[model samples]
Target: MKTVAAIALYSFREAVRNKILYSILFFAILLILLSVVLGSASVHQDSRFLLDIGLFSINLFGDIIAIFLGITSVFQEIERKTLYNVLSKPIDRATYFLGKFGGIAMTLAVQLLLMAAALSATLLLRGGSVDLQLLGAFWLTYVESVMIASFALFCGSFSTPYVSGFITLGVWLIGRLVQELAAFLDKVEEPASRHLLQGIVALAPDLNFFTITTQLTYGYPVGLAYFGAVTLYGLGYIVVAMGAAIFIFRRRDFI
Candidate 1:
């Protein structure tokens, strides 16, 4: 546990020093601020527009940081031959993998907190009130980002960084549309194709379930039961992905 914590802290420090991470965070905050300006153009719907833009900025930028950093975390270590030194140490592959993931997750949590704070401040300035529902929406967004980070880690475990990034992005895109794809599959006349599509859809993540920005914006009722279910789903996927990554990393031969 101590070793894992050390590695996690190392990863956190490394990620903090990444210029790209700062650049992306800067732009995300800039967009959140720009939302205020854009929202002001609307007469009565300014608050709604501002909330929408702020939430979207957080979600979009958070995902970008997760995917980029997650894909490269282990791969960069291997490419630079730093992984060999780490592996030669007392730490096992599973602990190392978990530490790396925990570090990235920690980084995402910090960035998400900042963005959520910005959103709340923006809302307060606009005469809009912050409530539990709004915070719940941000929590779900963080859940989605965590799931994406795990997916990226899994991809990076067995493939080159570029390929991992592509596959991670593909998974995200497909996951977002999994429900629509399932509906389309049901309409297909061909039985074989329908079954194939069904199998694919079953394996894909249900990201649509995490999206509650519209409900948050409109002040719609998002039940606690539903939120708990989606949070569990995201956490389940993260566990599965991390498990696979550890298994793969243990067996991988860095020649």
Candidate 2:
């Protein structure tokens, strides 16, 4: 546990130092601020429009940051020939992998918090109030980013960071449109095609479940029960991805 904790802290510091993280975060905040300007153009739906755009900006950038950190966490070490030194320590491979993902999760949390704060401040400046509905959306967005990070770690186990990041980003894009895939399933005329698509969709996580932005924009809050369900789903997916990452990393040759 202590080993994991130490590695996690080290990884967090390293992740924070990545200049790309700051660049993306700066743009995310700028978009959040832009939402306010754009919202003013709406006749009576400025709040709704602003909330939607603001949350969308935060979630989209958060996921990208997750992918970047998660995919590179392992590969960067190898690139610098530092993995050899780290592995020479008493750290177990599985423990080290968890620590990397934990660190990425921590970094993402900080990123999201900053964006959320910015969004809230922007709202306040626009004569709007932060509400529990917004918080719920933020919570789900955090969980979604963490889950994607775990998946990215799993992908990084056997591939270069660039390949892993592409794979992770592709999967994330598809998963975000899980609902559309489901809708398209019925349009397939062939039974085999339908079944294959259905199976693929089943394997992909429904990212829509992690989103409550529409409801928030409509002034409705999701119940605690809904939050529990999605949180459980996210945690379950994280466990599966992390376990796979550990399994793959143990057999990975760092040379």
The C-alpha TM-scores of every prediction are: 0.96, 0.97
Provide the lDDT at 59 for model 2: 91
Model 2 worst lDDT window (10 residues):
213-222
Q: Write one digit per residue (lDDT tens) for candidate 1, span 1-255.
A: 998898889999888889999899999999989988998898899889988898889998999999998999999999999999999988789999999998898899998999889889989988998988888888999999989999999999999889999999999999988989988985898989988888879999988788788897788989999889999999999999999999999999987
Which residue ranges in model 1 land beyond 4 Å of their true spot?
Answer: none
- Position 131, candidate 2: lDDT: 82
lDDT of each: 0.91, 0.91
Which residue pairs of candidate 1 clash? Answer: none
Q: What tens-digit string does per-residue lDDT give for candidate 2 at 1-255? A: 988998899999999998999999999999988887889999987888888999999999999999998888898898999889989998889989888888998999999999999999888888788987788889999999999999999999988888899899888988989899989987899999999888979999999999898888887768999998999999999999999999989998877
